[model samples]
Target: LLADDGGHPAVRTGADRLTLTPVAELGLGLGEGGAALTVLPLIQSALLLASAAGPATVYTVDSQDVLADPDTIRA
Candidate 1:
């Protein structure tokens, strides 16, 4: 699961106390362009997770309507 502590600097200290996997590049290396391309994969991953989780699961329950909607999520 991805968690952002709103970029708070203080959280960095506590972060060392917990195990956290760094997000993979997923072939998407750093860039100052292709904003849409970068976001599309992220959206796809979230949708895939939600779909596998099935309807009414925590994934569906927690996401906004559009996010959880199968019709709205592209593979």
Candidate 2:
């Protein structure tokens, strides 16, 4: 699964069995200096549970890595 840090389109192919949800769109203004960090773990746990039960694989791409060219990663 490939996820970007918001505003970018996610690449998905019919042959690929994965689901990538970009939580970047959630924004970072839930509280003072983005205190939503407290809920991040819970969100990840829920995603893990759903991924385990489904045929698709779910993974997170760091914001920095997501900005890199996919071709470069392949190399």
Candidate 3:
């Protein structure tokens, strides 16, 4: 799905996949699916913010670790 992004349009058709481009990029002649993708409006957190700044960190943990010691994980 595509929606206005600061006047430009963006679409995320799959996980870890997103694009901010012009309408002509749709290549409608390729197939009907491409044409339909432009119809729906999409709003997702995965979109980038041009004004955002600051340090950030991400962590991945196993469910077992949280089950074993929830307090430490919270800290």
- Name the best candidate (by TM-score): 1
For all candidates in order, the CA lDDT equals 0.49, 0.47, 0.41
Q: lDDT at 45 for candidate 3?
A: 24
How much does candidate 3 score in TM-score?
0.24
Give all candidate RMSDs, comma-separated: 13.9, 17.2, 11.1
How well is each residue in 1-75 modelled by candidate 3, as lDDT tens digits? 332222222333331265444333444443435444553432222233422644455666668887887654431
Model 2 regions more than 4 Å off: 1-30, 55-75
Tell me the deviation in Å of residue 74 in model 1. 31
TM-score, cand. 1: 0.32
Model 1 agreement with the true structure over 1-75: per-residue lDDT tens digits: 223322444543565457542233333333333334555687789899999988872332324756667455323
Which 10-residue window of candidate 1 scores lowest in summed lDDT? 21-30
Q: Work out the TM-score per prediction.
A: 0.32, 0.29, 0.24
Note the residue pairs that clash in candidate 2.
Answer: none
Q: Higher-TM-score candidate among 1 and 2?
A: 1
Residue 16's lDDT in candidate 3: 22
Q: Model 1: clashing residue pairs?
A: none
